[model samples]
Target: MTPSSALKAESPSALETISRNPRIRIRRSGPPAEDAKCVVYWMQRAERAVDNPALDVAIDVANELDLPIVVFFSAISNFPSANLRHYVFLNQGLRDIEADLAERGISFIVRRPPKNSLEALLTELRAAMVIGDENPCREPERWRSVLAHRLKIPYWTVDADVLVPSGLFPKHYFALHIFRPKLYAHFPTYLVKPENPKPVRQWQRPPNFESFDVKEDLTEGWKHLDRTVQPVDYLTGGTHAALKRLKDFVANDLAHYQDRRNHPEKAGTSHLSPYLHFGHIGPLTIALAVDQALKQKVITKEAYDAFIGEVIGWRELAVNFVKYVPAYDSIDCAEPWAQKTLREHARDKRDPVYTLEQLEKAETYDELWNASQMQMVKFGWMHNYMRMYWAKKILEWSQSPAIAFENAVYLNDRYELDGRDPNGYAGIAWAIAGVHDRPWFDRPIFGTIRYMSAASTGKKFNSKLYIRNVMENEPPPLLT
Candidate 1:
């Protein structure tokens, strides 16, 4: 069968275009395996069937090699800091993946751990080559590094999650001013969606090949898995759900996004962070939607600028942070000034130092902070303005700055649906250690790091109404 016109990229040679693209990182240097069965897409980060450059690359490679392509998603129960809330949403996305892949004539195989690692499954399938999506988080990056050392066949991974590939910037940008110009410089070239071409040959699953039932509980029997973080119904997972949310945001809230995003009491911001974290939705998808809305005069220029500033500017800055900063999740990731200032304030008195347990339980003197914690714990999400205030309060109250960072990370990773993401890590670092922030007048505990007072933060928004809204959302189990 001939390749469709849509499959043909700008360059005559699709292979050259893909291989030379900055987004595609060649993990293993080798040619396709001899007597290869098929091309495998080790879908992990970019889990969606549409607008996923990783899957597109795999399909392109399979078409170029004249072989079918199969998608291999590891529904491992042991993903670090992941829990029942995360898995339930992930599994929902998997259902959409299977359904979507079937329409494209691609075979979707859902696998579990113990015997079903990417290496084991790819080898079992006699894969010619493997393509994967990028995840900048420490554990996942380390997994890729180990696989690069261990895999015999060629492997390539696409930075499918971010609008701009993190590879463009070799090092972390200390501030958004430096990163924003660089981001927009390449936006015209990189912000467009992938071709999403279908494979020339549909994948044929070999005899004896096994996959877990799509409807079965992927987390079942994993005793170590944290089931305490129950799933929330307000924000369901999957590409369909993500797209719906984007549509709703554009239609209903985007026009007023600029005014209301900072106000926690209003439903102004797009609540798509969980979907973005889970890779059910890609940044390109959301950015394009917002851009389209702007062009169509559906939203004001100020609103568009404000929303894009967060999505493309600050969000990609976080991606760059985790990719380049070795100690991204800790106080060490802070700038030199931030580090020095923190050291100077090491002995600063913390009047009401809170233990990790106390912080986790939201038993703090600050009522606004307590409301934010309850919001995160009860709904698996929180308002961004509150997140900053929440982290700053932790720094002000914890035994030490390092302890504050550690406790913040533990809580962020433990409760929030978007925890364990670059944004979360970067947010924590910013709040505690001033990673992407500039130093302010020297202050207690926080030193020169920007201090967010609860009173001022609450004043900026409807603090009372926000607290009431959070409480009214649901009957929180542990909160009064």
Candidate 2:
């Protein structure tokens, strides 16, 4: 068959592979515009060129039509819970993606508008189809829905952030034990790498549109964003940096991860949360690399599986939690028993009750708690083990459970790069209320909810060392 005839015959079913994949979902069902020019990828969550199914789908659809692809990322100035730190980190990663995409002959345009600029861009391009990554977060979800409705072309969203897409499972799973097996069942089918489509036509120039140069605009972008929270120099965001961290973790830390994870003084954890949160790296990329280490015998299978369980298991479970539970960040989503028990102890508080100001400044009696707070404030990151103790104390010291929950979420989302995420929301819920935990022994203020004390934490790790290290070290200068 002639090349033109072959493409015509296969073009009808070219999108079938994407349509049938469990990872991809069609948000709006309409045939591609017959006389359209290019396929558009409205990039949001997944920032990397590598291992992105959404991008792959866009490439495939564009190739079938023998057309070029245009990728647009709307860097809205007022993304919820985002500040200077988050923007700096996210834009740095975006710079990497733009350079990478340029090498592959795809246009990567970014806009920093305060309003919804998607419809304008889509209309300008006269795109045949629109593609985007699936994000369960409230803000992204709303924006995507609005944009999809505005577009007159076919719009599809692909799940590339999580290893097993969040949509595959039931809206909410009670615990890791219940969700882990079900997640594993589909591993054989969905864990493989996504198809990478070769474009038949290459995009020559920047799409005939005016947009912000990510690197240049970032400086002025910060001017319009909240500058209260400054970017930390400790973690530079990008796929290259994220990959380096993952490589080092697999080589040095993965073997001891299961054993030393809880020790605050040790570097046993992979500090890739910021990168993962910003979509600089995908979970599947991290998981596949860990799996390769296991095959090479560089790391034990036990450690490999343990880390994978976390990368896919608990992380995706948290995504599931927020997907099903709209009020996941607040006390409204707490288990019935937990809500009842917490209310019973509402009037039982007796000791010092600190205000949100006091807490944000890390001015507390407990040295360990203060250090943890300081770490989060100064470094834009904190020890995983310290997070549990850090949050419980907020509940123990606040005037009310509701106030405590609000303060915890505010401080967490305000400072951390990984803030406003499912993991953060679910983690806070677990700490303040027994979201996935069973009722513990009744206490004065805690009642049946799980209680974590500084005393108990001290018994597990050298609290003095954690405090001393955090206090003595100087954090890297804020990125400008």
TM-score, every prediction: 0.94, 0.94
The reply for model 2, stretches above 4 Å from the true place, is 1-11, 114-116, 206-208, 217-224, 474-480
Alpha-carbon local distance difference test for all models: 0.85, 0.82
Tens digit of lDDT per residue, candidate 1, span 103-170?
89999998787767788888788999889889998889999999989998877888999888888888
The ten-residue window of minimal lDDT in model 1 covers 1-10
Task: Give the per-residue lDDT of model 2 (tens digit) for 317-406.
Answer: 889998899888788888889999999999995488999999999998998899989989988988878898898999999888888889
* Model 1, residue pairs in steric clash: none
Cα error, residue 46 of model 1, in Å, equals: 0.7
Instruction: Return the lDDT, model 2, position 84.
Output: 85
- Candidate 1 Cα outliers beyond 4 Å, as residue runs: 1-14, 474-480
lDDT of 1: 0.85
